[model samples]
Target chain A: MATIMMRVRQIAGIALYLGLANAQEASWRSPVNVLSRKGLVADQISTIWWFLFSTASLVFLVVITLLLIALFKKGQAVPKGPVQENSSVRPILYLGTGLTIIVLLITAVYTFISMRTLAAPSQKPALTFEIVGKQWWWDVRYEGESISANELHIPSGEPVHFSLHSDNVIHSFWLPDLAGKRDLIPGHPNSLWLQADEPGTYRGSCAEFCGVQHGKMNFTVIAEPRAAFETWLEHARAEANAAVSEEARVGQAIFMQQGCAGCHSIRGTAAQGEIGPELTHLSSRLTLAAANIPNTTGHLAAWIVDSQSIKPGNRMPSQKLSGEDLQFLLSYLMELN
Target chain B: MFRGALIIAGLAVILHIGVILISLERVKAKPPLAMPDTTGRVVSQEASSLLKHYGCGGCHYIPGIAGANGKVGPGLEQFANRAYIAGHLPNTPENLVHWLMNPQRLEPGTAMPTMNLTSTEAKLIAGFLYGYDNDAR
Candidate 1:
């Protein structure tokens, strides 16, 4: 029994640790790594929490011990009425109450201060992002350009403030190690902040259930050094600004030939539909189908072949295309450069 | 006081255990939710019926049928006649065929997934679509 309890505690601790996402620490099946300064902050906060919990527990144990002693002591219970003037109880009451208030006030202030410290508001506002929560996926936008689907790469050591919102139901964005949880509501916007103190990747998941694929709706945050992040951002901006390539040009014609533009978007192309995530940087994303499948040609093909198999009840419909058409379209997507 | 407290705690524990057991039994007795319609894979039926079965009518305003109305997808009444699938795809029969057969194949980045259907089934469904030309307006 003791071993079982210890195992449970160990499992829970690992779970809590994994819950904290940092970019460099590559967790299980996670593309992001936990090697970041935010990991340190999370550890610090966890320690503080444990310390406070232990202290309060000690106090509770001591009080309970006193109560048990009082309950079973040698004092003869005089079957009495309401004693008006209890001499010993009054001072003890004042002392206990005073001590409790002092403890509460101190602990409350400390917690508040720690939270404020964790919520780092930058002096210069180095980074900004808009995180949109859909049925189960995330639509992340940096500055004016939007990168669809799974991946988020930001410069290391820069605090990024995120404005989170939802399209349909309410969802929550949580990267426990990086910062905290922020809710995404349909009509309103909520905000949270996180910054990787070093170069790393961190795993994040939907803390709130938006729909059927909520459990599978996970994303990553990559905290790259200044140069790497800048290069990535440059590529993203280029993808946003780029025109349809020659290789994809014929495929683009075919894209319209098939009426795919009705519900999807590719910047600089005729497909500007908003019902779906932007495909401007489709190839750059780590996963497709709102994070349900990994972003690869075959998986993309399978998901496109059978979406219900991947995410049941999503609004997207299935289409039956010829193998040649499928190849051309897949090529066009891979050529999203 | 100690004896009384012990007796009360024991009774509370017993009641709590009983309630937990009863709740578990009640939960186990309930049936599961019905399996969803699998017609998403079947496109041999009429496009109208398929749309109805799939609940596309709930959010889409299909044009040909007078009563079939929904706002989810673009109004499909003249959707068949539209020149493009998403925005820029030239509305052509073969193109619509491709679009119908597999939309994601053409637009790797679109939010619309490739609805599971054989190429022939897509072409057959596209057969009912007639409004892609200028006459639908």
Candidate 2:
């Protein structure tokens, strides 16, 4: 008993320490995940959804109970045909059908009303990011500002908003653990938002039938300590002015000579092509080739050589560079961040 | 009852096949050349240069046009082969002309704005685009 008590005390102390560390001082504080939304209207809708779910469960339980009772009254040897109920079956039938219809009608009304109320006057967005989803990729641009995909590098604790749209075909922006799904239509922009609760990698995907390579569409909401992100920003700024070493300079020259900049932008150079992915912070990203391939030197080179092998139908073409040229380009691309 | 069940099962199987067909992304029929579709229209380098002047791909999808894969509009790969122009308009030159003139006349909620093309320019573009095909430039 004494040993168990001592162990309990120690565990309690550790839990208390961890709880203090996890206090809401440096974490996201929106209640959308807490209980739907911090908004009054959203909270009400969420409450209604929970209520309907519970009510459906209750009705299911009652029906199941009656079904079990009816089944057990006779075993497997029971009558093979539908049994006629009591002579007063009309009332029960009418009531059962009426209740079912009523439940469905209420649910439909509640769903429509709540969805409609999402755009109410009180539901003004907190912040917004223009997320233009493409074939197996997403081009997120901050409102009236530029947000390079090389670093999802969002400011911590603030509501980083998202305005969703598609580039190639229909795609959906869904960060299930953080926010909801929004459809990206061509020539049409839909809006959504999320405040990452903590500094971690929140994965999202394209939830619509985009094309042959729709399954590979994946993005991450990477939140970090504000100061750390600030350091990253400074590093990104310096990358534009990133001095080219002799080897990298030769590689940069190769990039230019090989016409890489014609289809890709390198920020502070003449290669202002917008057809390909931005190599501004190409090395900083966790994945490459629209998150289809892992970001390793060999993989990057392989992707540059034959991207179609990995992501079958992406827009970038397979370049047949010699081994030396491929080595040189890889060196240059790795220095982008 | 057994016959009824068989018929229902067969119908379900047919429906399943139809769904599988719909879900399968149909292979886009590539043209033999970069010329337009059903019509044998071909765009010139000068006329291609006119693409930039007009910014045709700004709100439309046109493969190989300069700054073509922009996010503002749908990408053009099988545009001419599409059965409908907008959401519901028929795929015909005159119908397309009517749509290009005023889209609201066709689909009330279309996001594509009327480009107001001249009869000559429209016919030329229609002919050239109708012939676009499978070969990569």
Candidate 3:
């Protein structure tokens, strides 16, 4: 029996080690990463989570203790029958009810405080932006600027107010490390505010199910210093830089001549199709196809050649182009920044 | 209870068989149509990528290309035999190349958008399409 017990302990230790190793290999996409807070809202959310956890744990312990006591004392009761006054049971019932009521009241107060804190607008002038939730992508536009897709940039230590809209169905925008979820409904505009305390990249996803590709509808929130953000904004507002190389010029010519102009738009060029995302500063983005893959030259070539293979059922169709044409197009796109 | 279980089991088997038979019948009921054979022409290896770049599969059904199953426009299985381009222009190599390069200039308000293909790119795609003609001897 002792040998068997030792073997069980060794097995348990191995299992625990394997579990830890697996957890370490988990990517940023995992929900387990939500424990790290980066913004003011997430801080409050974490506090609330701890409070609820402790309260529930205490209640569970108390209930389990009472149950165990009752079960063990079942045979030890005196033979006084129905005539005896059960004073002990009455006090326990009163205690349980009183504790439950107090816990509920505390929870209610916490929820009220958190909601008010979230709803209160920042006193300092917050940067205003609009984000439209499409079928499986987020169309983001800074105030009075051309639109971009899948990436949201904000200044650190400053509040940013977002006006959210939906073009087709309802989608809930959620940046777990920055703020809670907000629903974007068609014909109804909702507003949300977030203030990141640090300059870092936070990933977000469409929390609500919209369609077949809802799981793939991910985005990134980049928080930088005020100076850097302003510089980025200026760059975003500028027209596409002229192609400096011959290959890029050929690629630009192909982009304009092809049906790409029908769905995508690149400012300062004749390619003005509103069906897809704006591509004035396409190369500056970190990821493509709504964070499906890193924005590399190879990924760009593959995406341009066959976007359906990268993100199936997406609105962007595959383009049949020769290798030389694809190289030129890739060069042109990479130079957009 | 034993008899009731037997009846339920028997009914479930019958229902499962009925569903399979119905599905088989539906699959067999599709009508077959006489499709033209366009296997004679040599398709350029680069034509597939060019076709994808132009997004031709988004509107027309092109055979032998993945994701070319769009139904927005007419299928291009035997396009070589078609006498006119876009139902009006005469079906010549020059006309096809011209139509590929400038769809809007030839016919404004047409559903097909102008896919600015260069002359060389357009000629290559046209060649690949024309090579698939079944009637060509």
iRMSD, all candidates: 16.7, 27.0, 18.4
Query: Could you say which candidate leads in TM-score?
Result: 3
Better of 1 and 3 by TM-score: 3
lDDT (C-alpha) at residue A185 in model 2: 95
Candidate 2 regions exceeding 4 Å error are: A1-53, A71-87, A105-127, A143-146, A225-239, B1-137
Cα displacement (angstroms), candidate 1, residue B64, comes to 47
Q: Tens digit of lDDT per residue, candidate 2, span A45-81?
A: 5577687889899889977887788678754443768
Candidate 3 is graded, for docking, as incorrect
TM-score of 2: 0.55
Q: Model 2, range B16-135, lDDT digits (tens) per residue?
A: 877755443232222233323333212333233334334454435565453333333455565567787765767787775566555545665344433455565555555445545333
Candidate 1 CAPRI level: incorrect
Model 1, position A63: C-alpha lDDT score: 82
Runs of candidate 3 exceeding 4 Å displacement: A1-32, A76-88, B1-137
lDDT of 1 by residue, A8-105 (tens): 55445334443452222224234332323365455556766776988799779978987898799887555678756657668767887898888889
RMSD (CA, angstroms), candidate 1 = 15.0
How would you order the candidates by DockQ, starting with the best?
1, 3, 2
lDDT of 1 by residue, B102-124 (tens): 66678765534455556654554
TM-score of chain B of each: 0.51, 0.56, 0.66
